[model samples]
Target: MKNNSAMTKIPKGYTTITPWIISRNTARLIDFMKKTFDGEEIARLYNEDGSVGHAEIRIGDAVVMMFDAKKEWPDTPAFLRLYVEDGDAAFRRALQEGATTMTEMTDMFFG
Candidate 1:
């Protein structure tokens, strides 16, 4: 498919399968994603209590949705990997930006 092709079904600049995250603090998560991936905030909805009800962030042609965890809807575990052109440099920058290093970079057997 051409990069400039029109998407009839899905919206432009969005993929079919978007990842949704239900976190305790949606604002913090949105801020982190924006800072880490240079994402653009295209949509945001807040609840009466000033918590995030819903938000859509565009990052590299993909949109990720996030919602503040509610009493009925609790926080769920989510794993979103950020892929960059320079892995080594991004890893270092993520650390500097307060990302907890769970796995150190290493040569993968698949490579």
Candidate 2:
């Protein structure tokens, strides 16, 4: 791939890809992200029935967008890899927030 950022038109402080979560319990998911990752809530759009239609939370420099899975839409899951100052602590926090890991956390060279 060529480095064409100069020619590409993208929003400031935005990345090419953003993780979006479609969950039945979107409120809990948003709460999890906030408590576990110390995410900052950017904006949230709610449905007339008091369900979240769309929301954005910023963890570090990345903006994670998510919404509730409606009756017409199937559940869509998103897997995200985040870089935090304290990986172990973050993992523990996630576990506290009812998150289960497929495997134990491991250190990577890139991190």
- Per-model C-alpha lDDT, please? 0.81, 0.86
Model 1 TM-score on a 0 to 1 scale: 0.79
For model 2, which pairs clash? none
Structural similarity to truth (TM-score) of each candidate: 0.79, 0.82
Predictions: Cα RMSD each: 4.4, 2.9
Residues 1-111, candidate 1, lDDT per residue (tens digit)?
577444567876778689999888888777777777777898889999998999999888788999888878755899877667777876776677678988889877753
- Point out where model 1 deviates above 4 Å: 1-7, 71-73, 109-111
lDDT: which candidate is best?
A: 2
Ten contiguous residues with the weakest lDDT in model 1: 1-10
| lDDT, residue 16, model 2 | 82
In model 2, the Cα lDDT at residue 30 comes to 78
